[model samples]
Target: MTVDPPIRLGRAADAAAIAALSRELIEEGLPWTWQPARVLRALQHPETNVAVVDAGDELVGFGIMEYLDTDAYLVLLAVRRSDQRKGRGSALLRWLETAARAAGAERVRLDARRDNAAARSFYNEHGYHEIAIQEGGYHGAVDRIRLEKWLRA
Candidate 1:
């Protein structure tokens, strides 16, 4: 039987791999804004959490969230193509949400590409609600759906 990969805090060494995964899975067809340098910065940020699913030899998934005074923003979440549908993505998201709630965040917010129905459904399945739809929201290139999940009253 295959064991589920464990999720943990990202390290400085994992920045490049995480950035590459973001470029391939999340930022495809868009400008590669989450480069290694930027990812390292987030990893070093005090208010941000970069979580990864370490699959022994490599990282299979990752999620980056920035916690604010009242809420948290899910900057990105993605799993390697070969590792999808195995619950790694959902695990990473849940880990981040738990961290956000512990930090006193009332809600978690994120944006998904409107064309990616799978992602929309995935977030919705995780309790995220559609808050808005913005045309040209993705770097002024694609329509984006904004989603939010309230954590408390």
Candidate 2:
């Protein structure tokens, strides 16, 4: 038997945990573009919303997003390596989508590294479609596939 962690709205204090998880989940250490300080700033930004999944007292996963009147952008979503495939990432994503829809977002957009077949498949399974591909779109880290999903209005 196994237990799943609880997912909830994120707070400022979760910033460090989320940043660490991002570093662990993503390529080669944390990208310079998403240093801890930058993550903290995003969590505190007025337009952004963040959610974290807790493992005992530590956060194991997180998702961050931002929105305007009728549009939203999924800026980041990461899960601890040990916690992958347990539904934490999907929970955070569902929470973010619900939050975005509640905030009047009619559509949500995100970008994923095209080479990451796992990520691309995850998004596709969740109803997101690839809308574009940009060479060096992600700060030149790699080619990017832009994905978007329309919400029921």
Candidate 3:
């Protein structure tokens, strides 16, 4: 599932589009936790980052990552349902990793729900390994599985 290359850094004007795409793609309560307002806040935040894959003017996918110390935390990633399996997710992820490395991150971390097999597979295929899982990790609705990947040897 490969597409064209070059994922871009999301901007302030992209907040609405990113938020809309997330709402359409995410099938959980996490989007409800942040919503568009929270996304806008992240856009303005210095420690957080947002990257997107666009097809012309339409944003097809996005990922939000936060830099904490020497680690980059992937807070959220979503691709348009119609655009899934087309490499957008992977491209955005790669871009995030590059950004993180440039910011001195030695490793990247993310969390997925235990019920999300597809997400778990994606992370695994991208070199991320499960580190831990906490019961009722997602607002007591689902267990959150933490995954990590070292960027450098």
Candidate 4:
């Protein structure tokens, strides 16, 4: 069976799904945490969160962010386990970039675990470059690599 991809602004009800996806990604020994309540709170507050949903009306991925003057820091970007490798992550990222630009952001930044080679490769393919690396940044164990992408005006 085939499924149509849908990208749309997230609503409050999507918090659980978003959190579940995050937990799955991390629990599978990935490199992140899943906090459903925290994510829901952030999502309810438009000032710091945004999400992308699939055609099935399920939250597939989200981007938690914080604005720093003219730039937006992407705190997190995760796709559902069942939804990975289908271009959904890239589409959500593009949407986030567009949204950031519309909000007057000149650039966007995100940090990925240094050990997450898949994520690193994905970001590199999407025009994001490693600008810095924090040694032992994550949980005092795994290093974190900072990446940034400048948007065109």
Candidate 5:
């Protein structure tokens, strides 16, 4: 299905949908369960949270950015499974990069499980470089790979 370009900072009412989609993606990537309420709380907070909505007014994707001094951490970025390859994820990432840059962040970083080959490839393809491999990073069950992308002002 063709989806319209996403609308930014859509609405608070879509937080639950975004959280549910995020939980699904996280669960698929890792063996952990995420609480929807907690996710909703974080997303609804006015700080560095952002979401993208499709023309149908459905929550297609969301991204959370945490600003720390001179760096911005992409705490979460998830797109619904049905919307995976339709440029939603890329658009969300681009928006986050711009937001990070506006927040005085020189770079954006995120960690993906080393075993999640698809995610690793996605990040790499998106201009993020793996700077380090963290041994036994995921509850001592999986390793974590750190990725960072330098943003241009």
Candidate 6:
């Protein structure tokens, strides 16, 4: 019987691995912007939360969320391919959402590539609604679907 890794706030030391995971899983087919330096900046940002799941050996998943006055922006979320469908992604998302709500955020927003049906379905299952579609949103190269979830009435 083996227990799964726990999700926690990402540390500066985890920046490189998190950025690598983001590049491999989330930023695929797009320009690489979430590099280690950028990730470290997020880790140190006052309004940003960089959550990560450490698998002892390395980071198996990570999510970055920025909290604002009225809402939160889920900048990125991704779990390792081998760890998908095991609730890790959901746990990360829920953790981020709870933090946002605690910060007085009434809504959470994110974007997914238009071609990623799996990602769209995942967000839909988690109560996010499609708010709009931005043509060539990713570096003016890929179409993106914007999603939002209201945390309160």
Top candidate on TM-score is 1
Error of 3 at 139 (Å): 1.1
* Model 5: pairs clashing at backbone N, Cα or C within 3 Å: none
lDDT of 2 by residue, 1-153 (tens): 544457787887877777776666654422556667888899889999888888888888889899977889998898887888888888788889999999989999998887889888988989999999999776676888999999975
Off by over 4 Å in 4: 1-4, 26-33, 55-57
Which residue segments of model 5 deviate by more than 4 Å? 1-4, 29-33, 44-46
lDDT of 1 by residue, 1-153 (tens): 644468899999999999999999889999999999999999999999999997778998999999988999999999999999998988898899999999999999999999889899999999999989999999999999999999998
For all predicted structures, in order, the TM-scores are: 0.96, 0.90, 0.91, 0.86, 0.83, 0.95
lDDT of 5: 0.76
* lDDT for model 2: 0.83
Per-residue lDDT of model 5, residues 1-153, tens digit only: 645465577456766776677667755555544456666666666666665757475677777777888899988788777878877787788878888888889999899878878778889999999999989887777788999998865
Instruction: Tell me model 6's lDDT, rounded to 2 decimals.
Output: 0.92
Ordering by lDDT? 1, 6, 3, 2, 4, 5
Q: Lowest lDDT 10-mer window, candidate 6?
A: 1-10
Per-residue CA lDDT of candidate 6, range 48-75, in tens? Answer: 9999987778789999999988999999
lDDT, candidate 3, residue 17? 86
lDDT of each: 0.94, 0.83, 0.86, 0.77, 0.76, 0.92
TM-score of model 2 relative to the true fold? Answer: 0.90
Report residue 56 deviation for candidate 4 (angstroms). 1.8
Least well predicted 10-residue stretch by lDDT in candidate 4 = 25-34
| Candidate 4 residue-wise lDDT, 56-148, digit = tens | 645667766766779988877888767789888887887788778888888999999888898999999999999999998877787889999
